[model samples]
Structure formats: C-alpha cells, structure tokens
Target: MTTGTTTGTTTGTTTGTVRSRRLGSTEIVYLALVGILLVAGVLVAVRGGNLFAQGNVSYMLTQTSLLGFVAVGQTLVILCRSLDLSVGYVVALCSLVGATTMAGDPSRVWLGVVAALAVAAAVGLVNGLIIASLNVNPFIATLGTGLIVKGFLDTRFKGPEGEVPFAFQTFGYTRVGPVPVSTIVMLVVAAVAFVLLTRTRAGYHMFAVGGNLDVARLSGVRTSRTLVLAHVLCSLCAGVAGLLIAARFGTGNALVYSYGLDLDSIAAVVLGGTLLFGGRGSVVGTVGGVAILAVLDTAFNVLDVNPFFKDVLRGVIIIAAVALYARRQIDPASRRVRFGTKVSAVRRGGVA
Candidate 1:
C-alpha cells in the first residue's frame, strides 16, 4: 500500500508540472505584470493611505486610454513583424487636422473625422508600398515618413492656435456613467481588434506571414496584402488616438505629447509579452500592459516623484522586460538550469 501511494504521488506531481508548462508565455508575462502592479499598489497604499480611492483609479484609467489605443495598434504591427515609428507624428498631424477643421463647425465634425482617417490610411499605404515594393527596411521607412508628417504638421499649424470642433471635444470629454468617452472608445476598439486578430482567417495569415514570410508565401498566404493591411490598421488606430486626444484637450498643439507616445506604445506592447521579433501577442495582453503602465505613472504622481523620472523608469522597465522576453525565447534550458542553481544555492546557504 505504501509503495503504491508513493508511485501515485509521484505521478500526480509530474502531471501537475506538465500542466503548468502548458500555460502560454503571454499568460506567464501577464501574471508577472499583474504581480508587479499589485505589489506597487500595495506599497502606494501603504504610503498614501488609500488604495480604493475613486479619484486615483479614475485618473489612471482615463490616462491609460491614450497609450492603450496606440499599444493595441502596435501589438498588431509587431505581430506582423513590422513596426511603425511614425505613429506619434501621425497622431499629432491627425489631431492637428481634426482640431483645426472642427474648430468652428459642429456640423462638419464627422466629415473631418473621416478625412483624418483617410489621411492616416494613405500614410500607412505609402509606408507599406515603400517597404514592400522598394525593399526598404520598415524602421527606416517609417522613420522617414514620420519626419515628413511632422514637417507637414509644423507647416500647417505654423503656431499653436489651431481650432478644434466642439463636437469632437464632446467625444473626448463626455462621460458615460462616470466613465470617460475616450475610455469607452478605447475599450470598443480593443474588443474589435481582439476579435479580428484572433477569430478571423486574416489573423491566421498574419501570424504565418510574421513567423516566416517565405514559408507563408509558399503556403499560399497573401503576404504582401497582409503586410499592407497591418500597416493600414496601425495607422487607423493612431488616427483614432489623435482624435481622442484632440477632443480631450479641446485644441491641437503641433508637439503635444508626440515624442513619448510611440515609446509608450512600444513599451506597453512589449510588456504585454508580445515578442518584438513578431508572430505572438494578443489585444488582451496589450490592455493589461497598458493598465500596468498607467498604474505605474499614477503611482509615481501620487508619490510626488518627478515626472521626468517616470520616463527614465519606463525606459529601464522596458529594456528589462525585453531582455527577459528575449532570454525566454533563446534559452529555455538556461532558465531551468538557473532555477535549479538558485535552489541549490539557497539550500547550501541554509545549511551553512
């Protein structure tokens, strides 16, 4: 009976370990992020004396919407093994155009919004074409396009007094039962993006193309079209983000928060466990990543830390996350060895 019990126990332990290993890498990263946030929240609450404050939670969620939208788009692009460095400038330009066009006419609000989206799509198409047809690297191509977009915005505004439409402002500022309109919009967009990327045939093709373009082409996937569509969707998301910002601020400044937006989006996506090299990620992870970033920023503010330090800290965290992710990809055996070594070291120290 004792021998049989020992064997059963060993079998159960092995089965449990196997089940744990089956969990997706994204899920593991997400849990790590959640753990980090929880620890931060606890520390902040211990210091500030409140974790359940309505004001703090609302402020964090509201601020998250901007980066959240951009991150969702970035997730899609990265999944396709491409990057969009132009999102920040594209956003600035779109917001400027939307704000300037809507400044006086509430009736033409929809028209301006449509035009902004069209321009964004056009910019994306140009990026896709340059990269695909001309054999240009996506990084350089998007960077160059971003510069052009910035210059155009600078020339268009020539100053900071661009008018934004009242209706557009309403979309940014209006609340639905204490939730900001922008937040609602972000959620809706995320949900739609999630469904498209996970539940559709195009999504499968996207994964195939990202993982191995040559293989994907040989498998009869429309690789070029998939790349173009990914960029278009990315630009569209950026345009929507710009519109939300314009509505929230009630004006369009040529350089308003453009510099940090792209970095934040990239960081958010990476932290969500999407491999920078591509072929893996989900909108759900991206949202959680956004929430983690937002929480970190809020915690910094509540603790009276310098806002500049937040950027520095964000850079550190992003680099660390990426490094860890890369290590996970390249050295699964190394991780296991490291884990065993640590355990042995701990036992030795305890014995000593």
Candidate 2:
C-alpha cells in the first residue's frame, strides 16, 4: 500500500512538471491578459453596465469578425519578419469586385467569389514575384502594388455603389443561435492557421527563413519561395476578409475601411505576444489579441470614450507590451550579475 501511494505521488509530480513546462512565457502572458480581462469584464457586468449586456457582446463579435480575419493573415506575415501594408487596399478591391460581380445575381454569387479570390491570389503572386526578383523591401513592394490595385478599383467603380446579392449578405447577418457566422468562420480560420504553424513542415520553414535568412538559405531551405508563399497567403486572407465585409454591408464602398484596418491588423498581431522581430508566435495568440481588442473597443463604446483616444491607448499598450517582452528575453543570470555590479558600485561610493 505504501509503495502504491509513493508511485501515485511520483506520477502526480511528473504530470505537474510537464504541465508547467508546456505553458511557455507567451502562454503565461496570454493567461495573465485573459485573467485581467475577465476580472474587468465581471466588474463591468456588476456595475450594471451596458457593455456586459448580451446585445453589446453580440455586436462586438460581429464587428470583430471583419477585421479579425485580416489580422490573422497579418500575424502570419509579421511572423515571417515581413509586413504587408497593402492588405487594406487588397481587401477593399476584392470586396468591391466581389460585390459588383454578384450584384443582383443570386445564382452567380459563387462565381463572383471564385473570381475575386483568383484576383486576390494573382495580386499576391505579383507582390511576391516583384519582392523576390528585385530583392526589394517587402514594405515598398507591397505598398506599390496596393496603390495600383486601389487606383484600379477606384477607376472601375467610379462614383457608383455596387450591390451584393441578398444570398451572400445572409452570411453576414445570419447566426447559428446567438453566434455570428463570421465569428465561426474566423474561429475556423484561426484553428487552421494554428495547426499549419505548429504542426506542418511548411510552417517550420517559414520560421527558419524569418529567424535567419542567410542560415536558412545555407541549410538548403528555400527562403525566397517561403517568403513568396507567405505573401500569397497574407493577401488571400485579406481577400477573404474583404468578401466578408462586403457581405455585411451589402454594398461595396470605395473607401472600405479608410485604411484603419492596416493599423488594426498590426495592433492585433503585436498585442497577441507575437514578437515584432518574427519567428515566434502562434495563431492562438493572434486570436486572443483580437478578442482583447474587441473587448476593449466594446468597453470604450459602453463608456462613451472618444474614438481617437482608443488609438492612443492602443499605441501605448503595444509599446509597453513589446518592451516587457524584450526585457523578459534577457538572460536572468546576466541581469543578476548586472544588478550585483550596480549594488557593489553603490556600496563603494557610500564607503568613500
């Protein structure tokens, strides 16, 4: 009986240790944020605040679904140490084209969607090709492409609104019970992205390339191809996001989101604990970041805070989070030694 008890204790200890190790620093940070948010949410609820009301929650989720999709793609691109500034414009153009093509044609909704996706993919391919072939910086390459695409969209849709089919719009408004379909789609996308990044060789190569381009190339990794593929995926994500937005609005607007989405996507990626330097992040983090942002927005609306102030708060939060992450990455031993030396210097000065 004593032997069995000892064995059970040993197994329990082993399980605890494994569980502890499985929760990495990023996961810990995420958990902390979640806890804080939960507490805040509860407080807001107890205050009889409208933000915690069911209607607000549903509205927030609906809004988040649109930008959350783009943010997911942005996280992947940023993970590879690259940025795609053109995502907003890509989304705008795709949305416009999709809506225009499906205008009043319920039977051809799928065709329009396929065509829009093809265009998005083609645009992404072009962005990848130019960046890879010319060795141009990704920012400049994608920005230029984005401008061209935006211009084309403006010319195509000049001064007129394009209607989307009623059937397609149903996806934006329809819910399975209380949950929005867009939210479900975002969740699925997040799940797929998480699996790809964590479980696939392609995901591994993406990290390798981002972590060290020269080393990855030397190790027979296709650095260029990986980057190109990353861009393609990023743009594809933007395209899907655009379609969802169009469906929600039931019309295609030229301005789409007025470039706010670019900042929002970056904010979501950084807030999710994905290092700005790349090669270390998860789709789960991105999703959490999105949720945090959405919750904050809902809170702000409930409190009736100025819209512009949210941007200021967001910037400050991003800077502080990145700084904290950087500090954590420093070696503990090195930090301790530095602290010791500082103490020694102070003691000597006092003696003198």
Candidate 3:
C-alpha cells in the first residue's frame, strides 16, 4: 500500500516540477516587462507626457518591430548554445545590396529583396561552414565574419547609396490606428519562429543539443547541422531588419554597422530568460524582452536622458535582471531538495 502511495506521490511531484521549470522562466520575463512599463509610465508622467499617447505607442512598437526580428533569430541561435556576432554587419551589407539593386525603382523591389536575402544567405552559409565544418569557435568565427563584412563595406561604400521607391517605403511607415504594419509583420515572423521552436522535431533536436551536446550526439542528433541552421536563420532575420532600414530611410547607409544591433539582439535574447549557455527558453518571452527595451528607449527619450547614459542604465538593468533569473534557475533547492529528500524517505520506508 505504501509503495503505491509513494510511487504516485513521486511521479506527481516530478511531473509538477518539470512543468513549472518549463513555464516559470517565461512568466518571470513577462512580469519584468510589466514592471518596466509601469515604471516607464511614471517617468513619462513626471515629464508631463503620457507614455501611452498614440504617437508614443507607435514609436515604441516601431522600434520593437526592428529589434524583434533580429532578436528572434538571435534567440534561435542562442538556444542551440551558439551565438552570432555578425548580425549588424549582415544588416548593413544586405541593406546596401537591396537598395543598390532597387535603385529607387518600384518594379525592381522584388529583385532587390531577393538579392539582399541571397547575400544574407550566403553570409550565413559561410558562418555555418566556418563554425560547423571547420570546428571554429562560434564567437570567434562570427566575429571574424563580421569584421570581414565590415572591411568590405567600408572599402566599397563611402556613404549611403540607392533609394527605396515610395511604395516600398510605405511598408515601413504605414500604420493602422496605433499599430504599424511593420510591427504586425514582425509579430507574424515571431509567431512562425515560436511554432518552429516549440512544435517541430528540429526544435527538439536543438533543445537536446543545447542542453547537452555530447548527449545529443549520442542520441543521434545532428549537432553540426543544427548549429549551422541556427546561424543561418539568425542572419536571415538580421537581413530582414536591414530591409526594414532601407524602407524606413529610403536609402542604405553603409555605416549601419555602427548601430550596435548585434549586441542589442543578444541582449534581448538573454533578457527574455534564455540561458547564456544554451537550452531552455521561449520566443514569446523574447518578444516581452524587446518590449521592455522599447519602453526603456521611449521613456529615456521622454525624459531627455543622455543617450550614453541610457546605454549605461540599460546595461545595469540587464545585469541585475539576468543575475536574479540565473539564481532562480540554478538553485538546486528548487529541483533536487524538493524531490530528493521526500523520495528517499518514501523508498526507505518501503525497503524497511
């Protein structure tokens, strides 16, 4: 009788623990987003402005759209226990490629997009090859790739080049009520990515590889292929961000590499409750992280805070939040202690 009771209790407890661990991290991220917004509202109010004004809301969403795309891709790569540092460079290169191809012609917009993405894909392939085939450390491989792209960009383009047709530019500027069309598109991409991560066999392999590489290999997971695919997807997302820039500015600026998007995307992924070392995260939480950053950006602009100081403040906030998140996830008491002692006692009673 006691054996059955203890077995039932242990199974229920273990299942509960697993479910909580899966959902808890994402909940914490969303709660952080809410906290950020409330604080932003107060700061904006102090400056005699409403944070939720239609204009302000549009601006924040617009910002979220751009970062959200790149961050979504970053989330995928990070989930595989790898990283991409060439995203900013990919953005700059692809933007210029698209703009130069279009050359302000409406009919050529499709051609421009295809050309740009093709280049982005090529860059991603190179990154994947270096990392997966050559066995280069991902950080060093991607960093080198970024530098090479940067050198090529600086040498070839001295200033902004090419123009977006008026129609193409509308994709960046069009809004329905307070929501930008671009934001909608970004959300759709995120939705697709979310499904890919959570509802696919490839996704399971990625999580397994990330959770433990050797174990994944032993289980027949293709670690190299997964890593390569992650980097490619990350670059493709950054390329889309580049296209957005082209649409917004009506031209491609060579200096877009200076925008620091690579780091910012990584920051969003980390802030979204993803482990730096890989495995265990969700794209939904990443959207919340992007929102938090957008809110911060909007709030600082309203407060007239110095841009450099805003960077510092953002860094500090990320550090504290990540520290707390890590603590909760890594605490053994939550996992081991809760199950270990009780299960051991139950087993001992049966043995006795």
Sort by TM-score, best first: 3, 1, 2
lDDT digits (tens) for residues 176-198 of candidate 3: 99999999999999999999998
Candidate with better TM-score, 1 vs 2: 1
Q: Where is model 3 poorest over a 10-residue stretch in terms of lDDT?
A: 329-338
Worst 10 residues of 2 by lDDT: 1-10
lDDT of 1 by residue, 75-106 (tens): 88889898999999878877877777776678
The 0-to-1 C-alpha lDDT of every candidate, in the order given, reads 0.80, 0.79, 0.89
TM-score of each: 0.85, 0.85, 0.92
The root-mean-square deviation over C-alpha atoms between each candidate and the true structure, in angstroms, is: 7.4, 8.1, 2.8
What is the TM-score of candidate 2?
0.85
Q: Count the backbone clashes (under 3 Å) in each candidate.
A: 3, 0, 0
Best by lDDT: 3
As a whole number from 0 to 100, the lDDT of residue 76 in candidate 2 is 78
